[model samples]
Target: MTSALRVLLLCHSFNSLTQRLYVELRALGHTLSVELDIAERVTEDAIELFQPQLVIAPFLKRRIPESVWSRLPCLVVHPGPPGDRGPSALDWAVLDERADWGVTVLQANAEFDAGPIWDHDLVAMRPASKGSLYRREVAEAAVQAVLRAVARLAEGGAIAPVAAAATAQTWRPSMPQSARCISWQRDDTARVLAKLRSADGQPGVADNLFGHACHLSDGHAASAALLVTLPPGAPGELLARRDGALLRRTVDGAVWIGQARAASACGEGKPFKLPAALAFAAEAQRLPELPASLERPDDEWGELRYRESGPPGARLGCLSFDFHNGAMSTGQCEQLLAALREVKRRDTQVLMLLGGDDFFSNGIHLNCIEAAAYRTGDSAADESWRNINAMDDVALELIMTTDRLTVAVLRGNAGAGGAFLALAADEVWAHRGVVLNAHYKNMGNLYGSEYWTYLLPRRLGSDDARALMQRRLPLGATEAKRIGLIDRCVDAETGAKAADFESGAIANGLALALSHNLAQRIAAKHQARAADEACRPLAAYRQDELSRMHRNFYGFDPSYHVARYHFVHKLPQAWTPRHLAVHRERGTAA
Candidate 1:
């Protein structure tokens, strides 16, 4: 057993990786507090007040001040192999096509990522983008490395230092746009993909499309039909368009560019990343539009797709909505609602909602709503209202379904209204490593309404439900299970490495389990729905919630707009929020 220790979590942002570490450490009975990397004085003040026994910087953009590190041990999590030292470690790893990579937990020294290593773990690299790999493989390795380091610290022992040698570590600078630029005229499909993949989530590859210079992202190798329809265009020329992307012919093949961000004469602005079609509307409309086929192809890329499997009566229909970064626009919500209704019309015993690999959903798309303020000459408030209502429509569809038992299988982190959306299902299951931000207060005290006023109370009484909505913190899958937030947490056993929940193992396990007692589960679902309707109608719950939401969307207050603008623009933090910077709270510091 490990003794409880006060651990101060110092990070740049409470991102996915930091949230995972926060949840895991709290589960181990560690008293944890958070302090963003704001400034040296603020960090020093936190250290003096919290007086934590140990400090862990899960993610940091700047170096820890000497005043604090000299006082306490500060462990920095670096996404690189043991001997790799740099800021752009993952970027280089993906661009270089390394077969294996790892994460290192090292003590913060005068030099960055050069401190004595407490522990490190190697993870086989996946052919994924920097953001995807960071969320999955790098994150898993970091957890293992951090846990090993913490356990060693708990038990008083001499930790082995990483051996130093000449040319042991390599330092790589931040990748510039020039380095990420793709050459459609010269580069093959694989080379172009590597460049674009390295810069997927942020700082997309700078390139030209339709006589305009813009950054490209969300790339996919063309499907069979798309490949055949490439109208013999010259290299580097835009061939066709579909949905929100434009297809460009490469030296060997073609790639669909799903998103882009065009620079304007007004200098750098908030609309840095938008759907390719939306950003270049006129140009996109000129190209031939090829609608995605309803028939699922062997190899194709799309935001939504459906697949049916299982033998005879045990037939299962799985609908996956893999939205980029799990953000759903107003149109996306309507499209997915239609897709959900279509899948329900099919002949299947059970229906499973398989969300994206990295995120189940983070609620309505903030970026799209923010973009509407400028792109479509609409008020941000108007767009937000439409988006939230569309989200409610999708949730309502899930709530009213009675034919087949609906199961929400969360394989990734979910937040805000997304958590409540999952609750719309008959049964909600999640992978072990998943973290759920169940509260909406973090986004400027926005009172969320996705039929949550009803769905949440049904699971955890009235007062507990109210308290949960107010507690603005990330909940791990295990803790969420105990609090009755989810029906089941599959493979949530504690161990070293983070759970490989991204793999289809949990979904397969669920399919097998449901197959055994299909009739009873379906019957139980029906009876529960009937009983719930008798108690109180779902429409009443939606009305009550939407009434409060109306005040939020079209009220005198503009807190949501201010907060949403700051978030969508990637504004720098003025001061860390009191909830996260717990060390400053008079009596809250551990």
Candidate 2:
């Protein structure tokens, strides 16, 4: 028989799940305290009042303070597995078309969901509604897992933490309103549906029809036909109704919507009713489409331009490394490497610039992996091994080289290789809102760029680094700065401050020359020796761990199983043989 345990339920909104939890706990004769609208400091008060042995934070949007979490034992019920920790976990998993998914019950540490795992329940989900999957499947799984976890704690048995499988995968936060907008011109029906599903249960997808706000939903999506009027004076000015299917247009000579909502309102709440017409508003104005004749030679490096204002000679050559539109390609890496070498030889300073307002890079493109996997389908292990090797080569070169002073100036979010790129830099300057993380581990491949094991420990202490690597920590700028991972936090700006290095003034020029002279002297006497000796081994050890991590997490490609555990079963899967092996190795090695 189990003794009644005191459990406090923390949530933002009291949903059906919360009500069920309350009832279940009562039936078990365990005392329960409910706290809703629990944000920041309020959480501390709730904790004090409850003084419960176990805390179950479910659907709580606000981050709990470290002080509150440290006071007592607590567990967080995450919708995804340990590796799949993040907001919008379910939405991301569904859009990715993962075969399996699960929930995790983790120790409540200062870090978000990056705590050690107690247990998890796995679930398999079909291609279904996101709301149905979460409310019906995931919620039930979460309840069962919580009960099991509580039972384990009551028994006074040691809780085992499952290390997340390794891969250089990342989690993207919910896309902003602008990024989530539907681009009718560029998107196909399938793409549009994906976007609609992604933004479902949130603000629906917005479309701009000459400056009108037209929101579309799958609610009325089953209609077979639509009629749309082209902009005034444009080609195909006549309005006509046609089948509302994705098809190739005879006049346009491209894939186009067969039917669309007409400009004129047919009726209130009707399918053909014209949403308020408005001009197209994008986060960024679209660049003019390039002409086919303007293609650069394949062998030539693309010229990249950026601004660096300060005293004369004070501005360093900025690399502005970006992998937008897709993952970093081999050719792109090769071109970037050459650019870095050229900048080094020129004795210019370098700052890697990440393009796009949101992402620095998405890491190795999945398309590339899929293509390689298909080509070498007969030898899956060899294909994956080769892929990991190639990725490591590029990542290691970036981390080890770069003769000039390298600074990763992060103005936006960075993940996977983006995070690795920042870690490789001598110093990282992040904006207030930036997010940095080792997202690759969430994917099935653990052999992320070799720098994580070494740099992570150096930036955050060994204990924290271990937690981050295994638990997959996502640090905001302030948290990152507090842990010494980010050197300084600055606001986005146009002009320079006194403390900032300037580009053209006489005083700044002299300062740059003096700084350069000092840097050269340091390199000759200390920096070079330190790099080859201390840094190299540290980096190598990290790489070694990463290789092991890949074998442990993705060696057998358990992602499908892991995903099934979350989505369909809505229950946590037990540690696999591979996971146990890795855990034992770490234990014995330690």
The models' CA-based lDDT, in order, is 0.80, 0.50
lDDT of 2 by residue, 1-590 (tens): 46777777776654445644555565567776666543555556556555677777766665666786777766777788756656778777766656778888777776667777767888676554455456445766777787787777666755444444323335667656565555555654445555555555444456533344444433212112221223223221222211111222222222222122322222232223111110111211231211111123322112233334344444454544434322454444555555555555554444444333234554554322332322323333443445445545555655555354556666455666657757766667665445566646655534465466666777788898777667443555666787787787664321112113222222332344448474674355346536655746645665685667556435576672244224222222233222212222233221
Return the TM-score for each candidate structure: 0.94, 0.43
Candidate 1: lDDT of 360? 88
Q: Which portions of model 2 miss their true places by more than 4 Å?
A: 1-313, 325-335, 371-387, 444-447, 491-531, 534-539, 549-554, 560-590
Best by TM-score: 1
Error of 2 at 457 (Å): 2.5
Per-residue alpha-carbon lDDT of model 1 for 1-590, expressed as tens digits?
45777899998888999999999999988888899888899899888889898899999998999998888888899998877888888888888889998888888889978888877888787666788788877887888788878887666644444444224878888888878788778988888888888888788898877777878887888777667756677778887776677888888888888778786411345456777877787778888877775446956777787887766766678788877788888988998898998888887877788787678898988877777776546766788889999999999999888767787888788899888999998888886788999888888678898989888998999999999887788999889999898988876422222344434543563475457677787778788888988988888887887787778778998888888888876777877788877778764455
Model 1 ranges with Cα > 4 A deviation = 158-167, 264-269, 375-377, 492-517, 587-589
- Candidate 1 lands at a TM-score of 0.94
Alpha-carbon shift of residue 145 in model 1 (angstroms):
0.5
Worst 10 residues of 1 by lDDT: 493-502
| Model 1 residue 445 lDDT score | 78
Q: What is candidate 2's CA lDDT for residue 538?
A: 48
* Error at 568, model 1, angstroms: 1.0
The whole-model C-alpha lDDT of candidate 2 against the native structure comes to: 0.50
